[model samples]
Target chain A: MSAAGRTVRPVSIASFAQSQNVRKDNERNEAEGLQPVIAEVFANVGITKDDVDFICSGSTDYLIGGPFSFVMALDAVGVWPPRAESHVEMDGAWALYEAWVLFQEGEIDAALVYAFGRSSLGDLNEILTLQLDPYYEAPLWPDIVSLNALQARAMIDAGKATEADFAAIASRSRRDALSNPKAQVRHDVAPDVLLEDDYVVAPLRRHALPPITDGAAAIVLAAGDKALQWSERPVWITGFDHRMETHSLGARDLTVSPSTAKAAEVAGVADGNVDIAEIHAPFAHQELIIAEALGLDDSVAVNPSGGPLAANPLMSAGLIRIGEAASRIRAGQADRAVAHATSGPCLQQNLVCVLEGA
Target chain B: MAERCAVIGVGQTHHKAKREDVSIAGLVREAAKMALADADLTWSDIDAVVIGKAPDMFEGNMMPEIYLAPALGAVGKPMFRVHTAGSVGGSTAIVAAHLISSGIHKRVLTVAYEKQSDSDAMWALSVPQPFAAPLLAGAGGYFAPHIRAYMRRSGAPDHIGRMVAVKDRKNAMRNPYAHLHLADIDMKMVEESMMLWDPLRYLEACPSSDGAAAMVLAAEDAVSGHYPPAWVHGMAMRSEPTMFAGRDQINPQAGRDCSADVYAQAGVTDPRAQFDCAEVYVPFSWYEPMWLENLGFCGQGDGWKLTEAGATAFDGDIPWNASGGVLSSNPIGASGMLRFLEVAMQVRGQAGEHQVDGAKLALGQAYGGGSQFFSMWVVGSAKP
Candidate 1:
């Protein structure tokens, strides 16, 4: 009846898989695009649909241009007599959070979490404009890039960062993304050369913008004995939490992310020394903002898997960060890692996951 | 293994085709405020908030939860958004309950709403996606064929569907909040109604309603003064692919698995004899029987027989949808939670005019997305 001394249901990411990121994936529907990724994750975990106790997914119908798009994606899983499942409209990271909650109850042993988005299917910038207040800001049609530009300008004006710093982040991301097959944006241009390029939005350059992509990612979570039996090395989630800020851009303090700072604290991000971090900051300047909010130092390797700047696939981008961080633990690359995901414009909501090798 | 959760408060808006008088924030707040009042609490008592809706396209506002946070009194608190298609309402409630059962939060407020009047649901649903077969009509078009499949499999009489339509409408007369209250509803009238989809007459289908449903869930200690809390005996959600080779759209496996899991937890070996009443999401009339089998109220291929014998009627041994259900009132996103809230209302003896007589135990169910996604819960008067 009480949480004190309650059995901590340790759940681990058993297997993870993601699709190849591309500028435009016109050949396959969301289900077809996700089928191979789901199969690969299951194959890696050596399990079938029958072995899974629950299924949860993260997606937004806005990305695919329809309502109930998640319904059609069910064709990929081929549910017959139905299976225990749930979903989050935010991102795959939150879907994994839901599955973790169920696992904590000790009722379900294993769950599959997957998410897909076709950011290139529509005018993503224009579509994202709708995320603003419909009555106030949306009428102005402030696209994501323009909004980020405002933030970037504020950071510059506040003397917290410089345009060169934003360019450097983009340069390093592209250089790092060269190693990621799933990354859609990869170029070896130097930061100085990037600064020479014309600005897409005053202080922000085109290279700083994430490539619109079509992609899918899936992860399998197993709890307690299932986690121990699934693999030799397991990536255990130590702490997970998410928080949201007010929606109106005018109502927020555009310079700082209090939500991310609070979420990181609640998730015990400072309780242990983090070796690696994967932060979801689609815009280059926001990376600087979140890295400081998370209190990550230069010693902590950030976005070794290239992060969202490499392939920002809307809803799936955040989940991919968690998967990327867990993959490092499974590969014996790090003892502890932190993965973060953001939703809504100007990072209105943030989720933090701290993973440790077990 | 987990802390027990209870539904301390339930609230919903009076469903209608259009609620143009209020803004989106006002629509959701109406339900949230009611739920808060029911729990004898204020906005400050809530620890977290979870909201769900079908799609942002329905309101032409992407992730409206961001804008709705203040209206839901979620400022400076954790807020989460869930979209599991039509079953989002049920899933949203489940997530809130989990917060309590996890012992992380004592009080969680969950809300689901859809203002369909903002846009055409049919067009929103039919938006063409790259590299996909275009759906000619809306969801009804996609589901009609499956209903036909159920008809063919069960060998059910054509009139059976009409009977369910008439029965639910008559029941709606008792539900003051139901969207479609046909005072003169009858079998003949339903049978003669225009066919929106084959086997789904206009009267048999759920209306495109603008409304919202909200619930306040609390942990055991948090419900000290809340009397007659509808204890959450069991909760489960299941899903499968929309389609695959030999996948049965009629009587989806996810719905069956979800029901089995919930009933097992609730200690109900036989839902028919154990449950005094049920509030199930049956957007179309024929689904009443289809879901009867899926939810284990009857054996496979025998669900229609329960309808034929009037066993699912309000006065029957196992009453189903005594408040007219989704067929009579459906705010797509909130329809699932409406079923859940209705079940809670029954156990709490708070269902006013539409109260099922002495309903001690009840089942609530909802399914979405090609019938692949399903969420169900069992509620009872006694604390678990």
Candidate 2:
């Protein structure tokens, strides 16, 4: 009867697809932007929208300057005859979580998860400020850069990381992104050379910032036999969990991500040797914080798709991490991996998914 | 089903036009705290929290759940935000129930709210988009034509809308949580009221109120011993494209499919006979009959016959909105959850004066996004 003793239904990622990460694309609207990715993800798995029992999407309305923005995006999936559907305001990663939960119910056999964002359509930083505490923080209109700088300063003051460490992460990420064609920003700068760039904030250089991106991504999840039928190599989600810390920045220590640590523990992230990890850390220094919390070692290659720092689409960035990690396992590049997604300022809420090529 | 889930606690704030007394976090916490106390559980006993709201624009707050996680005691716990337009409240609770029904979490807290007074809902709904037509009529303006179409399709009398308004408004008098309590309400007053949208009088429309609703859902083994728990017999959510050539705006196919799925799971052959009382989302007066047909309580084009014959009144064979409904307290986001919470209350025999006598089963429903999104559930006193 105990929840901890209960076993979750085995679910696997069958197919993944994403739009080319870009600064802006004015020709296409949200639904138009998603139709190709949605169709390709299904076709890649030898199925169509009819094969999916449920559909879930992720997006924020503020980015589109309208409410119910996700409603229009539903058209991309061609849902008809009434299909079970839901949406999350956070990220496409959370939509995947919702779809996974439905799959676990054992009634639904498969689900389609997708996310789209046009960060270039609006003032990205100003719009993000609306995500802060409305009564206390939102009125201040503090941009995301300033808030992340405060977290970076806190990390430096705690002796957990420095500006050089931040530059090193950025240097490796962009360099790795050079191999990623879908990536928006790819370069070959050394850590020392990257550190020479002028600071966007006091402690963060231009390399520390993620490029504003407009993109869409979709993935299909199948249960048990359906998983094996859909793909030659299915990346099974062994464990999954997400946790949130207090909203107040002052309430947290800021040097470490306890929520990520808790989520990792619940998700059984350290159960076996990890071959590759894709962590959604938009800020350079935050990567160090999440990596430490997840207890990843140097042996684990992080952000081979260059992570969020390479191509950060507001809502799609997080799900892209899961897709990147799953694609590696599917392509016979890795046996085991962990994908992480963060929401709120300074990683206030964190989700961890442990996947294996079983 | 993966596992069994039940509704152990149901709580709602006193819905009103404006709740300036509490901050957004404080308002939701009020309902969450009550739900916890009702379940005889503390914040620590809850495993995860799921929150939903219509849109961030309703309160000028984006992703409010991230900031609300602390107030809902979600620190170091999984917290989810569900946004499905008007049906978000019901969808939020369904997501929380699925967490337990899937054997992932034991005790989950679900809450939904809208502080309409904090920001203008009309302005948010009518915001100018670059290449799209604005919903200039707002919600009522968009739906009034649908109501007119329903009347045209069914030949329903004009008195049906007025009858529903009087029944629900008077029913609000017995429920303290309802936002509206019209003591002198009557058919004459309703028919004479200001007509906002043609065929939809001011009295027939739902009020823009600020409120929140919460529920504590538990797995089979974690049910509270103090109070009778309402077992979640079945739940379903459905969505279709907002606009299409063959779409039926009057009785949406999504709502029909959603209700049929839930009813089939609950072994309901005839909803009119199976459910003792119902809490349907009736934001506009005509929606009462529109949804009665959509939910399959009666055949299409015949839903008004039930209303015309007083079959949906509190004393009728199949009572609807016994505790009033969205028409009484229209907190844009929480309206759906309120319908969900009321069914739980009715099934548990906890609804006070407005309670239906010997009510053992109930139907809860919500629809949103131009009637394209639907969330519905069945709750029973006996275990499924």
On TM-score, the leading prediction is 2
State each model's TM-score restricted to chain B.
Answer: 0.98, 0.99
Q: Considering the two chains of model 2, state its CAPRI-style docking category.
A: high
Model 1 docking grade: medium
Q: Which stretches of candidate 1 lie over 4 Å from their true place?
A: A1-8, B152-155, B224-227, B299-302
TM-score of each: 0.95, 0.99
Evaluated with DockQ, which candidate comes out highest?
Answer: 2
Off by over 4 Å in 2: A1-3
For candidate 1, give the lDDT. 0.87
Error of 2 at B12 (Å): 0.6
Q: Alpha-carbon error at B353 in model 2, in Å?
A: 0.6
The per-model DockQ list reads: 0.60, 0.87
